[model samples]
Target: MVIFGCVGIIAGCGSLGLWLANRIRRRPVELREFLMALSLLDTEIVWGATPLPEAFGILKERTDAPWQGFFADLQDRLQRGESASIAWNDVSLAQNSHFCLKHEDWQVIRDVSKGLGRSDRQEQHKQLELIQRQLALIKDQAGIWSEKQAKMWSYLGFLCGIAGVLILI
Candidate 1:
């Protein structure tokens, strides 16, 4: 019974560590997705001259989960006569916990909607380009951090499990 308990404890700790590591790993990937989505939005707005709602619809169709959900919600809100800024803020606030982004990342994302539909095409393009550059920097940092920390978290969890078992024994 004690052995079984120890094994269970170890497994649980290991799983938790893996979960943390996975979350860390997902940060960069999600950021990259965001960048891609932003690029597409830039194309739609600048070159194609597509309006915000239809642009979001295209984004919704092009992206995957989380982003797809975000764009879908934003598109819905825009169609319902909500301004782009308000809808963006609303969606960001409502779905904040669903993402693995950091506070700075969220801040940048929130800043995106400020000049969105209100600005001219050149201004909007510049804004998106700036945001993309910032996100790219963040993605690079996150990728480096994840590479260093994920393994540490995974190992630490197993080590903690062993320590706990030792204490119990």
Candidate 2:
């Protein structure tokens, strides 16, 4: 009877842990999809020689719903006397790399800004493509990480449940 009780407790905990992991794992993928879509638009704007501030602002305005929070945060950081690099660092911390900007992304931003002045649209486009590709790669890696973490959590939860049962026994 004690053994049975232990197994029941373990099973319950394992189920709960798996549920939580599944919930946590789903959002980042959606975020990545949204970011990938945004990257396409951003690439166009950058390559067209649009000013970085204007491009960012426009993108922020166009973004919708849950996704907007990140861009809004980025805009706020950028507006409050933060350099692009610093702003990106904050962004990297706040968001998963799939959706959040990074140092390299900022470098592209800086290059686009400079390229615009130099009328080097080609370079700006090239940089935009590079950034988009980087983001795509990050998104792919993030997907793998999320899946792996979810699996790990499930396995650990199972182990924990087994331990709990053994304790009761």
lDDT tens digits, residue span 1-169, model 1: 9889999999999999999999888899999999999999999999999999999999999998888999999999999999999999999999888888888889999999988999899999999999999999999999999989999999988999999999989
For each candidate, give its TM-score against the true structure: 0.98, 0.57
Question: What would the TM-score be for candidate 1 when compared with the true structure?
Answer: 0.98
For 1-169, candidate 2 gives per-residue lDDT tens digits of 7767887888888998898678557645554645564574456555555655555566667776444565676668777867655665566456644433335434433343333323455665666566566556666766777788888888888888988777666
Candidate 2: segments with Cα more than 4 A from true spot: 1-12, 27-31, 34-38, 47-50, 61-67, 94-122, 141-145
For candidate 1, give the lDDT of residue 19. Answer: 92
- Could you tally the backbone clashes for each prediction? 0, 0
